[model samples]
Target: MSATGAAPRRFRHGLVVGKFYPPHAGHHALVEAAAARCAAVTVVVAPSRRESIPLDLRLAWLREVHAGTPWVRFVGRHDDHPVDYADPAVWDLHCAVFADALGGESVDAVFSSEAYGGELARRFGAVAVDVDPQRRAVPVSGTAVRADPAAHWRWLSAPVRAWLVRRVVVVGAESTGTTTMARALAERFRTAWVPEYGRELTARKLATLRRSRPDATVFDVTWDRDDFVEVVREQQAAEDAAARVSGPLLCCDTDARATALWEERYLGSSSAEVRAAARRPALYLLTDHEGVPFADDGLRDGEHLRAWMTGRFRVELAASGVPVVELRGTHEERLATAAAAVEDLLAAGWAFTEPLLPAH
Candidate 1:
């Protein structure tokens, strides 16, 4: 039987491709158009192409950029020929390879602005539709963002631009290597990272008393309420800084949720307000496995403290409502797990970006 004769009654799939460099409002319109025109849209974000954002950052940006559109998803690989697109022979090869991979998997139509899409569609036995809402070539082109990341952002839909503001935050008690793990994830993902806010306040101890605590001087400051609030403020400031300048994704070491956890540990209860302060992150990277012998840098007293801190930190952050990914094993293993999780989120058609800091 012919392939077309066996096809589903309703259009089963749609294929869309682009560099999607921090995909903006215009990109959103294109995907929405394709989704509306078909059953499902496969959004191939080709980070491998030149003039594209880094692969990990591209995946993160795509997730937050198209959060509400459930029909569209992301892929790392693609069939793209940026310079040779004008030559049909080369273009056809690009289409053949990409189309065979994506189109072979139940694709019934292809939606694109590229002129060669129609030829590829016929080869793949799918309908072809070209969509270009804004006809002006140069201004609407994605090349603008590659040249100036700051300027063309305003042209994007408010939500998509906001998703581009996201940063992944990892929270834990002192001695958990939160900063080290954060740096690893950032380096692995090729994005910015927020250092631990508590260390900036603490005199080395993961949870220590403050200078102004009238009850006592140093020793175990965990019970000090004033110190807890101070740490929370410190975390809040860090999260704010991360989101403001964050390009694609920000990996934060610790958040206010960790502060609330410390409060619960020493004070024996969590703060509703402090917990509320942790709603900024799109997702949390929680650590489950321990690594190497921890140093007693005055800050990291022992493994018991680290374990206690991890437990308290986990409960509080989970309660705060940010989605969390528990990382474990070696640095390579942990970051690899996180990288995979981030990519999966982008593939499922959800862009996870919260605007600025969530209002307390």
Candidate 2:
């Protein structure tokens, strides 16, 4: 079926070939168009070793986008095939590669958007069905997407978008509403949220410590470096797992950067593991300590130390070299600022522009 909804000459088998480095809407249109016209469609993903994403991942993205479309089959192998798209003289070599890749299957039509589609179709003894040869249907390409995915994010399939989803971590001192804001952001974007794991671990440790000594309080038991280290690891695991299940964005309440700061506050020193985990996120939404009244949950250190820890987060975030945007004002105002930052991230393809200081 063509994009116009008219039945093009039906073929027993149709072929669509591309590196599909990161399959965008143009590729999807080509596949859908081909699938509409052919009894069975085979899409090829040929990735070179230099491709940033592995070949298997590209295949997975294609599989996910074309899910439930039984006629759309994909072909990829773990072989270092030659990528000579520059010279037409190498066309025969590529034809042989394609023939071998397709197992010399009988093909009736070739669907593509490139000028070389005619030649590729001729090699297969099939007619070329060029869909959006001028790229008018979807004015985006893999090169443009790779250069700035967030800019062309709408041109991408949800599966591909999910793969490129950026993590925006909301980190701040106690009573800063990091949790509330993270949840709100996730809901706003209709994506997943990773809750602060460190809080849970800290609560569990405090409970155990308090139960062991009924007279002593939570803050009396000094959390060691290992405790913070475990928190960082577990936090990362939870974030990663949530990201897998998330859509185009994953909102994290807090990450290892906070763990590092807390480690410094409690243990007097942060470990290499904690510091490493505190590295750059897509962006950081830091809730400012000012204006917001400190609420002492059983877990909070107190109102006085809120500023101190907030200062420490700034120091660690700067030292860790991550992009940060501090949010102030009421909860709604902070949420708006954070949402705008996330929108900007989505527009910029999550590219990092600012320089970061080296970890000391």
Candidate 3:
């Protein structure tokens, strides 16, 4: 304990470096443990040659995971890449860059399992403590997160776990089959989904509210448009709040644009009120895989009408501003594509219920 004299008093800073591609369970534990012991722990989300994950997203995951924590700070890139370690001294240069960031602030401890990490800590006058490389005590590591994200979600921060529950809302025209597609996505991703709330409500209220046909009685289909519009507006707002709060991502059956289309097509004009509500979902998905058999919702016209309705549906959704995923192909093909698309979306960060929960 005697360097100059009894190892001096413990420093307050703790420097922890990591890639944090997705900030899995193990990383959270490491961070939590470090934050507990250090006065301030600066997390450097290390840069990658393969930027499969962008710096901003990596930071976002860290921020989302550790949203409430006050001691954490993120720094991703360290000097330039590759470090030209052929020179051997390049490590010192790279290490200097990191130390400069610390600027006169010396860490009481440096935590890492990498071989060079201990030496690096010594250079900075740190107490170089090794976190279990085998993940025996704290199972947090960038590699583990990349390998099995879902299985080890409990290793992540509680806030990160909570942020994952959302239903991906899928929107499409009547008979374009959003219900089936949404269900398919849920099955494919093995998660809970929120069906088109408006459609379900509309299906029940079709008889009570009295909707006008698009081509009937001189093509004036606006009768009671406000009623349907209002109903959809309410349901959308509810689903949105739920999605943002506790989401596995809602698989929406239709967007407000669908209702807007119905109003414009059948009611002769669109509702400005409903259109405003359309901006809720972070993203809007529209199914364009046409020619699927129509279910004849009692309000539907005779054969070959679904294609026309779907076209009108697209025209309306295109204007809603939420990024769209237009699905196309035969019904089965479309469903498969939709499922794959959902998988991709989930990979890209779709919320789902029953996802991995964080451990204490």
The numbered model that scores best in lDDT is 2
List the pairs of residues colliding in candidate 2: 1-36, 1-37, 150-349
> What lDDT score is found at residue 350 in candidate 1?
32
lDDT per residue for candidate 2 within 20-68, as digits (tens), equals 8778888888899888888999887765565667778878888988887
Query: Compared with the true structure, what per-residue lDDT tens digits does model 1 show for residues 1-360?
Result: 122334334457888876665576667676777777677788776533444346566666667667777777777665344435446676566666565546458677776766656765776677876666344542555655545444564565444444455567776655555688878767876666888666666554433343345354334534467677777787667666665555456788776766777677667887777766656667788876367456666544345677777776576666766778888788777778888877654444332222121123
Give Cα-based local distance difference scores for all models: 0.63, 0.79, 0.61
lDDT of 1 at 230: 70
Looking at model 3, report the run of 10 residues with the lowest lDDT sum.
Answer: 350-359
Q: Residue 92 in candidate 2 has what lDDT?
A: 70
TM-score of candidate 2 to 2 decimals:
0.66
Q: What is the Cα-based lDDT of residue 229 in candidate 1?
A: 74
Query: For residues 1-360, what per-residue lDDT tens digits would candidate 3 score against the true structure?
Result: 112223333448888876665676667666775676677888877655454556676677787767677877776663344544345576676676676666656677777655556666776677776555568776566555555445555565544544444345676656676778877766766655556555455444554444544334312222476665776766666555545443344566666666676666556777778666664454555666355666765644424545666677666656655556677777688777666665665567532222122123
Q: TM-score per candidate, in order?
A: 0.49, 0.66, 0.60
lDDT for 79 (candidate 1)? 38
Q: TM-score: which is higher, 2 or 3?
A: 2
Global lDDT of model 3: 0.61
